[model samples]
Target: MENNTIIKTSLDPRSTFDKYEKRPLINAVTTESYEPKPQAHNSKIIIESIIHGFDNFRKFSRFYAFMGLVAGSFFSSLLAVDNLSQLFPTFFNGYLQYIVPHFFMHLYIVGLNQLADLEIDKINKPYLPLAYGEFSFTNGVITVASFLFLSFGSAWMIGSKPSLWSLLVTFVLMTAYSINLPFLRWKKSTTLTVMAHAIGMTTSFNIAAFMHMKTFVLKKATTYPRSLFLATVVMAIFFAVVAMAKVFWFCVSLLEIAYGAAILIGASSPFLWSKLFTT
Candidate 1:
């Protein structure tokens, strides 16, 4: 009887210990599942914000603006070619056949911008498609190549003497700007480079004229009838003014100076149909 009673007591202690363990385990499970509802709600908001931010990110690309500027520069010059002939009477007779390639010159400017600021763009413009790992260098090459091909091809098709020569000059300038601007240290040669770029910018307007007239030399005319001459002059002045204005608006640097000059000068070349407005 004593042995049986001792066995029962030991078994009874084990049963109690098991019951105690079960209660703690049940409490732990309940505690773990009982998270505050607000935390779950806040997590959903975080997820939503991330999604929305990405949507906004795509809408803000500046590539469109850059492309527009390139296209505008080309089209505007085409408009002025007819009137430019009035200013330089012999332009068509002597140089009319070379204007076909003039349309592609803008590519030189855009390419130079891309090449010069590549490293800086990677850091300052991390959000840019190129830097964000969204766009590949191959894509850039394709884009530029397509622009050149279209512009030059169209110029070739036009078969205008001036257009062809203008195209050649543009190609050469682009090559020079891409290859030698760095050697000239145009970024560091502030005034001299700015003036050279300005001359190039001003020349772009004439190149556009070449496209319209299909020639480069002006004939011996007393006065050109088109008011576009005045408009070209005005745009050139305005572009120069804006170039200088950059000093007041932002900190001046080699890159800024070179680009500011480029933009202003390039901007002047595009004011097509100036006569339509003036008269």
Candidate 2:
């Protein structure tokens, strides 16, 4: 009887092993079926995405470049208004008025450029935040649009005529150059690109002069000097010529021209000379 029982156990051993193995498989299937699927999109996820998008935008834009541009514009305007000695005393006070508006204007331009160039950037510069998916398209558009509105509104509120005109012109020209609107994307052509940059730089130079006159000279002086206008035109012509060349050496040459022209204009103009020498 014991021998017969052992024989039966040996023959049925495979059946017992199969039953135990199948139990975990059935349990796994049941557990998976009951598990919740992740939500594809949600408010929390969206908020986090947008926050990341802003961070990416800031990094891609190169914050220091914007600061340098604003500083150049501010100091150029100050020099137009007063001599070096006189500028030191009032520099901080005047900088405060122009900084916010200039910052927003620069942000608007850079944001628009990045927004429009997303596709090109993927091929040419994949590391860009927008190209790399670090920043969402919708958030980028909203951020740029906000900067545009803030720039214009702040310039208007400050009542700085140069700041207002500069912001408006820069926005319009940069939009035309960067946006893919029909017949407006000037960035496609080398000639148009150079032309756009030249015009933008020239207008920015004028803006600095206008800001200076408005801030320091307009109230005290009866007539705006002709020499200053001539100097601005000369600077613009030189800038446009050098910018068209589009070479590194040309850019350096333009800076030298700018300094020489500024000094010549300041020294020659009776009004500016009187201001510089008299006080």
What lDDT tens digits, residue by residue, belong to model 2 across residues 61-171? 769767546645654555455456545656555665666776787888887888898998899988878788877999889878888888889868767766677777777
Per-candidate TM equals 0.45, 0.62
Q: Which candidate ranks first by TM-score, i.e. highest? A: 2
Per-residue error for 198 in candidate 2, Å, reads: 2.3
Worst 10 residues of 1 by lDDT: 214-223
In model 2, which runs have C-alpha deviations exceeding 4 angstroms? Answer: 1-55, 80-91, 209-218, 222-279
Candidate 1 has what TM-score?
Answer: 0.45
Error of 1 at 254 (Å): 20
lDDT of 1 by residue, 55-87 (tens): 533433334433433443444444434555344
Candidate 2 to native Cα RMSD, angstroms: 8.9
